[model samples]
Target chain A: MQPTSANFIANARDAIADDNLQLAIARVGENFGAKRQQAVDKLPEFDALCGRAVEIKDDVLAHLDYYLEVYERAVTASGGHVHWCATVEEACETVLRLCRSVDAKTVTKGKSMIGEEMEINPYLERHGIEPIETDLGEYIIQLAGEPPSHIIAPAVHKTKEQVTDLFHEHHRKFGKTERLTEGEDLVAEARELLRGKYLAADVGITGANFLIAETGSSIIVTNEGNGDLTQMLPKMHIVLASLEKVVPTLEDAATLLRLLARSASGQEMSSYTTLSTGPRRADDPDGPGEYHVVLLDNGRSELLGGEFQDILRCIRCGACYNHCPVYTSVGGHAYGWVYGGPMGAVLTPALIGLAEARHLPSATPFCGRCEEVCPMQIPLPKMMRHWREQSFQRRLTPGRERLAVALWAWFARRPALYHLGARFAIGWLFRRARGRGHMRKVPFMRGWTLTRDLPAPEGGTFQQQWRRRKRA
Target chain B: MSNKTQGGRATILGWIRGSLDRGELSAEQRAAIDSRLANPRRNLIPARAQVDHAAQVELFLEYLGAANGTFTRVAAEADAPKALSEYLSSQNLPQRVAMAPDAWLQGLPWEKGAPLLERRAGPARPEDQVGVTGALAGIAETGTLMLVSGPDSPSTLTMLPETHVVVLRASQIIGAMEDGWDALRKREGQGKMPRTAIFITGPSRTGDIEMHMYLGAHGPRRLHVIFIDES
Candidate 1:
């Protein structure tokens, strides 16, 4: 069951109503954005690095078919099995099939948007395989059975007390004796519970942050070692990745890696950056016996030849979301689906048709903060406008919105009538309000003035004031 | 971004991918791959960076301090156990410390009375205070330590403990990211890499709750790096 934009908006409003979430979000953006600026200031060639990173992605995408083949060959050469999935269903089926082949009863997963995008947990559940999310935030959300609201912080919508209650409720079945009191206590409790799951799980699944074509290595950056454990310890390891994650070489990936952590969390680097190439060797005492790489194309192949190609370069750093005014106001869940924030606004409509996601593009305030802070320098506002144009062309926009825009456009093109009509309406409306200096009700703007009063017009219209100034 | 195109005109991307499919590499991709391939010809692909005793000690202190890890430079491998014991005693850690099965660790001199449990098979309990192991390599760029699983440092010692104490030798330091990958390749041989090569930069942290970072979210809360200058 996919959540619609309306449902997400309701959830986000509730999340914003929480005092803790607001305070935490306020502290995060200011500190993280400042630290990232400091890091970039030290590196004189940061912009050049971004350009190079963009270039590498662009080139790889142009030759994606060849590069994917090269990556597959390299992985196979390194004794890792590579599975190609043309769609999300195929990708999910491939992972489930692998799990079944291994007779996997328990599966532990790292935080992967790809996993979220494919709805992997429910698929695994249907097969009677319990997929345990190892990342703390992911684990919390999995227990709550909710889709992640934010990209970086999946359970950002949750408060500490909520997490505590969740843990208490979930841990009751496990016969947990000690009740956690603080945030730290809760973390320790989760760790103790997940440790056994890590060791016992037959298969581990994670999403690749980036896949190196030259080395057949899949890069996963995590501040927690959950990703590491998810890739190791288990006998079988699977890395789910999109086609756009491929890079030409390790050096190119290095440039992007430098930016990823600083932009995401203001860290010099994530606590754990694991690069796994293949399965364990004979000399290795403990590691996964079988390694699998699932490359999901989904809609990316079509996106390659479209206007949304630039979105493929996103590193999922969540910087845009952190700095975005709309995102800060309404939060991530408001946009709905796997991805939220500005990226989701442009991407959701692209992946799923504009009609199903018409309201998502309209969710933004067009403050342009997302584009300004975007490390990839994606023209997000322009893309949103593009979607708006598409919606208008398809008549997916509401009748009222269409009428309003049409009226504005008609008056805008005819200057004489527009000015006369604007002046008369302003004066007439003011007189009708009986010197109240504001209006509590307007025709189409009833929704707008319902909560607050609209300030009366100052003096007269701009055209009238300009004419009087010219005469004087 | 346009919905429609001319009768026969292909889009910018169509032209690019179509040409690439015909083996006509773009000027950019060709340039990048060529430059990378040509790098070895210019400079004999230098050996991995090495750190000596003093340098390793300096790096250990700097990295540990920067990354919120505690470090003590010991004069000899014999003094390692004493420093570790002192750290644990001060922190009120349990009497028993889990030691990895390594030859270098076995050579350490400890208090004659204290009991140190050598690592065995199976899951480690929550009561476990510390796990000691040697790092496979250290990355200078990110101040990270690469831990490879083997007989020397069993994998469980890394994840199971409340505190992790890593004994690092200075000489194994590598300068570049590629140097680390090269070393891993050489160690694993062709077509074989470990299922996991964890490059731990600092303690575990997450900003999941409205982006308030809390360290020790899932892994070891405390990391102690013991720099050994055997040189």
Candidate 2:
């Protein structure tokens, strides 16, 4: 999971040129975007619910230490262990040690963003425990040997034909020879194969949508129910969650649950919303024998009470991802990280350094759709602007860009020189058009002119027009 | 716990406190948080789920159908076994099924009604074609069924089979998810919860393959609810 955010421009160019990626991105934009609108339209209290959700998450962040302690005490009371890890390396080692304790060879995994952040699969493989992704999108991407392109929809960049190829190539080892074309057959084949994996795996790992401090339970919302089986059939269940996921109570979790599925995939409810408190009781018929939670910091604790604290309220619904124009155009791989789209643009630089991910904040068109559609009311565009300011202050921006901005500022400080320069530039550009309304090329703006013609400057500057109007 | 884990916990909590510019919480703030956790308040409930008893039942049925789940309403609890058998025969599924061993489910006269069906009460095996269990509550807001795992109610009955049959009493219908949580809190008491509590809306599904949703991805393909009118 080494970031290619430094090479975002190249990756975006490649994504834009990929036909299959374009088709998949269009489906996300058209399908998920329209469905979200319809779901929102159906709920009259959607805005009110979103406001309340924001309040809940903000409250959690303000007193995160208290809530985490309450949550840990509750888990301990329920016979579960809580492991706190400040860094990804510590988190990975904790998981490996737990697996080793159970003498586990294979572990089934539900879709977990923290797992992606920790890069636990590769870490486990290096240590001899094999991790299997049971979620369909995650399984597809795992076989393709690629990181998830989308947070919710991991293999969203792959076409069905590509999936057919992936399953055809990988399922050969399982003695399946025929190539499946229909989506149903592909799902069936994977389900059949993974059923055994779920039974055989010694441990299960899942991410928590919310950890309730009232009851010390971790909740997962999913449609396919792979997570339910993963935790139920295994000997141990380990929940990987960041500190920000903890909520105060079950009622708070319910309020957020009302928004999660609709914002994520336009469903009234996901097929399965399971809350696991601890391992099986003595009188219980069947369940995991051991329960553990790995509470990760991984830079999230540093975001508290800062200008970027609102980003921690994100529920990972992918509504902002669906609504982002740049994300829809370039797909998620171009972001070159676990998270993608508007949220990723703001969060990547914070988790990783701004120097390594300077291009992400600058990649936005600032249409404000992401902010408008966010369920938690996070000001994504404003946070991206913050990142931009920090990058500029750090001089992480390219030298040429800094020089242009500095030169513009130098003239901007003198209004008279700025007006004179503007007038000269406009007149020269108008003449260069040679009576045409547009120019195919422009100096130092080739990026803008590459895709579409630049409109020739029409009329004088705003100040000139204002003076002339006053005189008349 | 290991020293490393304890140190990590202390360090993270310290960082959070430092970032917030506070070393310790005042007496009032701690008291407020304690009360909030003790008595969790219910937030806004949508108008769609706020209804009378009869209307709530109607809304639940409407949403269940909308979510692609099928159901049958019976006047008595004894009718569930017959209805389940009919459903299995109609769908061309196997006569044998894995059923949850809840007292209410076991008390039913499966021998008198649907005698041809061979039912085993336990956790579902990999080869089970159908699973039968009783639901804790039916949510009227989104046609969801709340199933909690316990000694009698195995969690696997809902997931391993291709088809799932849920028996619910009409009296158990709730107006919203908040109501369901309240019921669970009353049953399990404060600071206690079951190992697993699953709220299932419909059959398993996925849209990852080109965004074309296909049912029965890894869980039950069909979810059938039998509402018994205990009133």
Instruction: Give the best candidate by DockQ.
Output: 2
Q: TM-scores for all candidates? A: 0.86, 0.98
User: On residues B1-231, what C-alpha lDDT tens digit does candidate 2 reach at each position?
Assistant: 578878988999999999999986888998899899999899999999998989999989888888889998999988988988999999999899999988989889888889999989999999999999998899999999999999899999999999999999999999998898888889899769999999999899999898889999999999999888875
Q: What is the TM-score of chain B in candidate 2?
A: 0.97
lDDT of 2 by residue, A1-472 (tens): 9999999999999999999899899999898899888888989999999999999999999999998988999999999999999999999999999999999999999999999999999999999999999999999999999999888889988988999999999999999999999898999999999999999999999999999999999999999999999999999999999999999998899999999999999988889999999899999988999999999999998999899999999999999999999999999999988888999999999999999899999998899999999999999999999999898899999899999989999999999999999999999999999999999998988999998998998888989889999999
lDDT of 1 by residue, A205-268 (tens): 9999998777688989998778877777788999999878988666666668877887787776
Give the lDDT of residue A334 in candidate 2: 95
Q: Deviation in angstroms for A422 in model 2? A: 2.0
| lDDT at position A58, candidate 2 | 93
lDDT of 2 at B72: 88
lDDT of 1 at A400: 88
Tell me how far the alpha carbon of residue B204 in candidate 1 is from the true structure, in angstroms, after superposition.
2.1
